[model samples]
Every structure is written in C-alpha cells, then in structure tokens.
Target chain A: MHVSFQVQAGDFSNAGKVSSTVKGILKQLNLGPAHIKRIIVALYEAEVNVVAHSYGGTITCEVEPESVDIMVCDTGPGIPDLDLAMTEGWSTATPEVREMGFGAGMGLANIRKNTDRLAIDTGEDKPTRIHMCFDLADGATHA
Target chain B: MTLRDVVQIVDGTVLCGDDNLGREVHLGFASDLMSDVLTLLADDILLITGLSNNQAIRTAEMSDILQILFVRNKRPTKTMLDLAKEHGITIITTPYSMFRSSGLLFSKGLQPVY
Candidate 1:
C-alpha cells in the first residue's frame, strides 16, 4: 500500500496528521506495536520538522509485506550543515516555534533513533529530503 | 497507578475520558517539550506537561500515551480536548506545577519513564 500527504509549513495545528493517518494504516495491517510506534515517532518528528522549519513538504509512505519506506521532502531554507543539524542541541527554529514546545533540537536525533535506516539530503540552496526504511521482520530490532 | 488515583493525588480535573479514570498507568514522564516525550520507550505511560497546546495531545497520541495531566492549571483548548477524546486519550488538568504533579505521582508509586 502507498499513501502520500501534503504538509503546510507553520501549520502546527495540523502537525502529526500524516503520522496519525499512517499509524492507523499500520494498525490495520497488523504490524507489531513496537514497529508501529517507531514509525509513528520517526514520521511525526519529520512531519513536525516540516511544519516548524520548511515552507512546505510532502510525506510519502510505501508499505510492503517485509518493510516500510518513508520519504519526507520539504522546500525551505535547507540545512546548511547536515552534521550540525543532526546534533541533539542545535536548532534554527524561531522563538514562536520554541514556545510551541518544540525546537529542542531532538527532532532528527529521535528520527535517527527510531528508524532502521535513514538517509538525508539537504543543502542551503536545496530542498531537504529524508528517507527512512523500517524492516518489518525485525520489528523493534533495527539492523 | 490508576488514573483515578492520579486525579486525586494531583487534584486534577478530568476534561475528557472520565470513563477511563480507572485505567492504570505504570510510568510517568514530565516535560514541556513534545520532542523529549517522543523519545520515551515505555508503554502505558502518563505524560505530565505544562504545554497546553494541541501538540501535547498529538504527541501523546503518536507516542501511544493514553493519559495526559496538564499542570500549573493549564487548560487545553476545546479543540485539543476534542482530539484527545477522538484518540481515546484521558485528559486531566491540575493546579499543581509540573514538578509537584510528577513528584506527587512519584511519591504514590508511579515510576518514572527514564
């Protein structure tokens, strides 16, 4: 099964909607609870990242019998330093974003912690893309 | 501890999911940051937070946290409560600060989700 969602930047009210929808589908598929939780966590962080930092984005998920692939692509002021952005305490979120209880700089770290595999592509002048895959066979155990 | 016990311990008001007051939560995590809340690994945990926004409810929903206690008399908006109700998440509000709420729950045997 495949699903896609459009995410609007600064849409904090609608943040997590994509993750919620994907989670429902995962539940209907009878995926393990642990696996579903990890997917939701990763997808949610990515979704929020778009809402908090991007101009807009799209989230696409392809669910297979053995694994799930997720791609979040956003147009925005892309990260100039991927390594710094990956750090746990580095963020460029606005004060309003921080007041919303996000921008603690744990978004990418949380995504990294929950996915089996992750790939990020971004530059100061390019759109950001995060690709994540989770192997269903392993459930909570990431390879 | 059962959510009923949580309500009394922290002097909280049940804004939604009153029927679920008897539900038991073994662990509790307190934070205003939803990102920190997402990093928790335990199931059946209760979230105690000062954030009174929709994201708090959304965070609990995504993390599979069934109960949320808003501290410092912070009340959630009607929309936020509605979302919690839709997700079957119990929402409660307390006059106690976040620290006191967590401390009270901890004193009553609710373990921290460390």
Candidate 2:
C-alpha cells in the first residue's frame, strides 16, 4: 500500500497529522506495536522537520509486507551542512519555534535512532529530500 | 501510578480527558523540548512540561504518552486542549513549577522514563 501527505511550513497545528494517519494504517495492518511506534517516531520527526524548517513538503510512504519506505521532500532553504544539521544540539529555529517546545535539534537524531536506514540529499539552493526505511521483520524481533 | 493519583500529588486540575484519569502511567518525563520528548522510547508515560502549545499535545500524541501535566500554572490554549481531547490524552495543570511537579510525582513513586 502507498500513502501521500502534504506538509505545510510553519504549520505546527497539523504537523503530526501524516504520522498519525500512517500509524493508524500500520495498526490496521497488524504491524507489531514496537514496530509501529518506531516508524511513527521517525515519521513524526521527519514531518515536524518539514514543518519547522521547510516552506512545505510531501511525504510518500510505500508499505510492503516486510518493510516500509518513506520519502520526505521539502521546498525550502536546504541544509548547508548535513553533518552539522544532524548534530543533536545545533538548530537554526526561530525563537518563536523554540517557545512552542520544538527546535531542540534532536529531530534528525530521533529519526536516525528509529529507522533501519536513512538517506539525505540536499543543497543550499535546492530542496531537501530524506528517505527512510524500516524493516518490519527486524522490528518484530525487538517486540 | 494512576493519573488520578498524579493529579492529587501535583495538585493539578483536569483540563481534559477526565474519563482517562483512571488510566495508569509507568514513567514520567519532563521537558519543554518536543524533540527530547520524541526520543523517549517508553509508552504510557506522563509528560510534565511548561510549554502550553499545540506542539506539546502533538508530541505527546506522536510519542504515545498517556497524560500531560502542565506546570507553573500554565494552561493550554483552546486549540491545544481540543487537539488533546481528540487524541484522547489527559491534560492536567498545576501551579507548581516543572521541577516541583516532577519531584512530587517522583516522591509519590512514579518511575523515570530512562
């Protein structure tokens, strides 16, 4: 199965909608609870990153019987340094964003922790693309 | 601990999910950073935060946290409360600071989310 969602920039109110939807779908698929939680955590962090940093974005999920592939592409000021942006305490979020309880710079770290594999492609003037994969079989082992 | 016990310990007022007070929570995490909250692996945890925004509710929903305790007398906005209600998350507020709230709950036998 496949699902797509649009994420709006600075749309904190609707930030987790996509993750929530995907989580419900995963539950319906009878994915293990631990696997569902990991996938949702990664997806939610990615979705929030788009809302927090990008102008907007699109999230595509391709769910196979054994794995889930997720891609998030955003039109915004792309990251200048992937390594630096991946750091846990480095963030460029506005003060207002921090006030809302985000912008701690752990979004990417959390995504990395939850996903089996992650890839990132970005440029200063181009859009940011993040692809993540979660192995259902591997996740089931942790359950 | 039961959410009802938490409310009594923190002297909190239930802003939403009154029916959920009977629910049990195994751990407590206190943070204003949504990212920090996301890193928590445990479920059925109680989040104590000073932030009273929709993102806090959204983070709790995403992290599978069962209840939220807003400290320092912070109250969530109408929109935030609505979102919490929609997610079936219990929201409680206490006049205590985040430290005091967490300390109270800890003293009352709430475990850490580590």
Give the number of the best model, judged by lDDT. 1
- Write down the worst ten-residue block by lDDT for model 2 chain A: A134-143
Chain B TM-score, structure 2: 0.97
Q: DockQ (Cα-based) per candidate?
A: 0.90, 0.83
* DockQ of candidate 1, scored on C-alphas against the true complex (2 decimals): 0.90
The list of candidate 2 runs beyond 4 A from truth reads A138-143
Supply candidate 2's per-residue lDDT for A35.
86
Tell me the TM-score of model 2: 0.94
**How accurate locally, in lDDT, is each candidate?**
0.92, 0.88
Q: What are the iRMS values of all candidates?
A: 0.6, 1.0
Candidate 1 is graded, for docking, as high
Query: How do the residues A1-143 of candidate 2 rate in per-residue lDDT, one tens digit apiece?
Result: 98999999988778888998998888888788888888898999898889888999899999888899999999968999989989989888888778877788888988999999999999797899999999887544321
Best by TM-score: 1
Looking at model 2, the pairs that clash are none
